[model samples]
Target: MRTAKRPLQSQASEAQKQAALRYILDAWEEALHDGIEPEMLANAALFAALADLIDLYGEDAVAKMTTGLSRRIHHGEFTLRRTAQ
Candidate 1:
């Protein structure tokens, strides 16, 4: 029996990783709204590590992740980094 190979583009790309990071941050925001202390920084770090494993966008992915993170932080969600300190 022969197995089919997956297409290269079908694999997780930098955009996909960035989208995932956005999703994670969104969830974190929701959690914050609900008074849950979600580990936003930890999750972001993990996502970054995972992003490094893929062969897609490196800096671009990080930039998107930062943007999403900043937006959430500005909106009063759980902060990954202290802004006023």
Candidate 2:
């Protein structure tokens, strides 16, 4: 029996994604140890990370992803309410 091989582009894309995640985690660990604030990190990191994503994925694909992201955010949004103990 033989296993089917993944398409080259799929394999390459997965490899690139893994590499990018590793790179992000490494940089984040250093920044946190250096006491970078979470709010500050989110502000700067979002732009940098999205720019890198747009560079890799192209504007149209990223734009589509953003629409999906907005949907997820909407679903994840919560309301605060007072509860009786």
Per-residue alpha-carbon lDDT of candidate 2 for residues 30-76, written as tens digits (9 for 90 to 100): 99999998688878988986776666666666665677766676675
- Write model 1 residue lDDT over 8-27, tens digit each, in one string: 23466889978987997797
Model 1 bad stretches (over 4 Å): 1-11, 38-85
lDDT of 1: 0.61
The clash count for each model shown is 0, 0
| Candidate 1: worst-modelled 10 consecutive residues by lDDT | 1-10
> RMSD of each candidate?
10.5, 10.4
Each model's C-alpha lDDT? Answer: 0.61, 0.66
Model 1 per-residue lDDT at 9: 37
lDDT winner: 2
